[model samples]
Target: MLKKLYLLPLCLIFFVPLIVCEKILILPDHLKNFWIAGVNFDYFSYYKSKVLLILVLFSLISLLYRLRKDEISIKSSKLYIPLFVYLFFIIMSTIFSKYKDISLWGFPDRYEGAMVLFSYIIIFFVFALVPKIKDTQIILNSFLISSFLIGVISMLQFFNLDFIKSYIVGKLHIFQLQYLGKVYIKFNPGPRYVYATLYNSNYVGSFMAISFIVTFILYVLNNEKKRIIYGILSVIMFFSLIACHSRAGILGVMVAVIFFAVYKYKEILKNFKFVAPILIIYLLVYVFINTLSSSYIGNKIESLFVDINKTITNSTNNNLRDVKIYNNAVCLNFDKATLNFVFDNEKIFATDENNKRVSFKFDSNKNEFLFENPTYSQLKYFINNYNNMPVLILNNGYDNLNLIKTKEGFKILSFSGKINNINPVDKIDVKGKEKLGSGRVYIWSRSIPLIKNTLFLGYGPDTYALYFPQYDYIGKFLFLGTPSILVDKPHNMYLQNAINIGVIGTLAFLIFILCYLIFSFKAINTLKDSSLSTISISIFFALIAYLVAGVFNDSVVYVAPLFWALGGLNFKILNN
Candidate 1:
């Protein structure tokens, strides 16, 4: 019974990705409002947490039972110190948080608060304590199988397997066809990007990126026939990764490959004949996929270069010209300079050198500005004070603007407008033409300042959204079309941690990760068992890829557990 109980957690681990892939299996309106830990009691996250909690409890019970019989011995490692310290800080941060509920349970939108953190810690300890080679194999096999299923489904989606897509969508009613919106551009619309079972294509890419490395490592360790099979799986996952069209994912895989090569230079040289065939196969598959979808893939790659070049040469000149204001039955043309204050069709106010308020009435018939006390100086002041309004002064064009007063300063609220040909600026709506890092540069620039104020203790876990608004000036200008868009977390995971849990917490977390990596790599270097060493190195490479991708993306519910679980399994293998 105790042995069987251990299998339950492993089953739950595999079950997670399957349900998450099917879009969280959200409940209906009446049932959706049911809350747990302050988050909506959905099937995916809620059930997964419950299962993990049960697993933790069962593992504890089993441990106690074994302890009484003297069947097991407690083993300690260097990792426990930093891990416990990090958990301590997590508790302290949550307790002292201004929003304790949110800190403890996470925000309703993304439940990754103290509770989830606790669950992750529980999972880590469970694996670390088990210290069984067979258990480690079970976890790795489960991961690979789940990942393979995801890869196959994503490939089918990419090929427009409508029956499969329809079946999955029908089963998971939460899956929306138009979820991509502005993120992905569909030129022909068979399926521009494949999200597979993940929330977004980038997420699918992140998953596939890790899977690719794992599958390749399995191929490397397997015998002749098994190597051939694993090699095919690796190729399939690589293609699926490309289908996701995630530049960050591709970049991460490249980085991992470089790292692996540098680390295993001797092994590569010794096994050149084995590696060369896999490389050739990879190249052929790449060419075939690229050729099959030349317009989509080729254009995407080409646009990347164009966007990079544009960012380098793009000037920040004022391109807000031919500004048109419409009120009642009147339309008036104003130069980029001649817009002092625009308050969303409610009012227009401008001030002169004498601190005199100038008011303008729109003439319906004339379609021009009618000043109460018209003068050249007043007109000049109106133009000169254009900067005073909360309008976005893009180098490309002007957008309909609204002003809102905040504690910091005047913030812009923009409405969608078309860019004129005379002075067109690159708007954010032109999908695939975004600046490098997908506007992360601007987001990070605004977000970095908040860390100084909350250096010791942060706002709270999963409370980055609370502080995001104050630093969202660039977001407003960039996403003029989507005014309601809110960036809760900085794209970078490290930055998100720093903002949410403070510098000390972030440092502790980093220490834990570094220690895990150090220990795992050391084990891999010294292990005599080829299969064990290969698996260890594989997990390390996958983690490296994930971390590399994380530099451009924050941790999500779908991926974070997988990372932590795999890390824990590494610890288990090391101990064994």
Candidate 2:
């Protein structure tokens, strides 16, 4: 029974990547984010619910053995300290959380991070209980098999069979592009990227990067014949990452390669005699691949900075550059209206169609308009005239101008921008969508002050939506063009932590990262054994790459198998 239970995790591991495409009905519909698993027999809804069921089973196991105290091991001790610290901070923050419920149990009360942490605890405790390297091999093998399958399936999706997307969506996916009665799995962006059951290409890129590093490390562990197989796997993972077209992931791979070279310098440098021939062969191979490909892969690689500025503008009906320009114009008009309010002693109360008031006044003493400052006059001399329109429009579109009078105030017009015909107070109904996808730019801009306000304790988990308006929802006038009227998660994880948990969580989180780096570095440094050294080096560099990528984007979090795998690997080294 114990062996069977141990094998259970491995069993699920094989199915993790495959289960994402299966059909299942969800209870609340919003539980879908965590449900974006790969192809599987079970529907996403079933898998999500099953995670809870598995948690219950594990909880029972913990309870049944709660009275039976097992001897502690070196690995468990090292792992538990950090785990406990994370939990302690989370619990303490929750008590003081403006969003107490989410802080304790996750936003939907599912405890995704806690579940991940629990899984780590289970693996560590089981390792201590069993004290077997064979168990570690089981988990690693499962991951290797799943990653191989995922790579193959992702390649198939790039072929655009339409069957894959159809089978995955289970229903008619209107969001997916349909061409010639077939659902095309390419974004409208130039050179169209494929997002296989994954929500974004970046996710695919990150997954591939980690998989490549693991495979490379495994290749290092293998004997001659097995090394060839792992070598092929590395190539496949690298190709898949390139196909994803994630610049950050590509940069991460380069970082890993550089780290590998520096760490393995002596071993590689020993073959200095054949270096010139190897370099010549590599150049020839690169040229051959570039010439053979029909896709502009060579050109794209050469010109990484594809001017997406034209992309946004060309898509919009108006001369305005794109959705960004439109959004900024709205913000611009709102800011101007706010100034009108202050000067005339009129209170500005602009809202969306929903009648939710959107404007707020900043502290008058510190946050004054630029025009009110003496510097504005000097700066204005460089340009024809300085207008306080939303920054979005002036930068992207809104070249021509006119003015009109409304019941509330004077309305400015620009021929190059879309006309604002609808009442500014009417809400445009932008709820429950990816508010912005240009990545962390807007979040960094808006979340700074919120972080400062909660300098010590933060507003609490999931309180950004409630408090964002209090700071800078600035109506439709200022034209900052932030996506949603009701702002939520601050996009960046670091900012989100500072805003939700306050100074303590930020410090603790940073400390956790610091400990991870220091321990991994120490392990790598102490490596006398070749296999141990390789594994430690790979794991350390992979963590570095993951952290670098994660700073700009959200990650797999605790529920992700990668998290558990990494945690288990670190614990093994600490114990060893």
Instruction: Tell me each candidate's TM-score.
Output: 0.73, 0.62
List model 1 lDDT by residue over 1-576, tens digit each: 566565556445644655542224343342232322122323334444545556656755665666677765668777788778777767877888888877887764466788777767776776666545756666777788888888887888777773444654454343234443422211222554586656467777688878998888777655446677778889899888877777767878888989889998887777778888998988887777677777576566566566557667743322222233322111122222333333344354554433355576656453344556533222212111233433323222333233333334344443332211112222223222233466666567557776885678877888887776532333444433233355667888888888887888788888988878887777787787777788888889988899888887777666677787778777777777
For candidate 2, give the lDDT: 0.47
Candidate 2 residue-wise lDDT, 1-576, digit = tens: 574463454335334434443432332333332222211123232344245337435533643353254522332344356556555555565677655544544443123333343444454344334324435555556666766776675655555543455555544354344333443323232233445444456666677767777676556544446556766676666666666666555556667767767776775566444334444543554455445445454665543334233234332211111121122123222211211111122222324324444444444454322344221121111011124432111221212222222344434443333223333232232221112234234445555666666676766554554555423322322233431233444545567667666766667667767776777676677756665565556666666666555654443332244644555555565456
Model 2 scores a TM of 0.62
Top candidate when judged by TM-score against the true structure: 1
Give the CA lDDT, 0 to 100, for residue 150 in model 1: 84
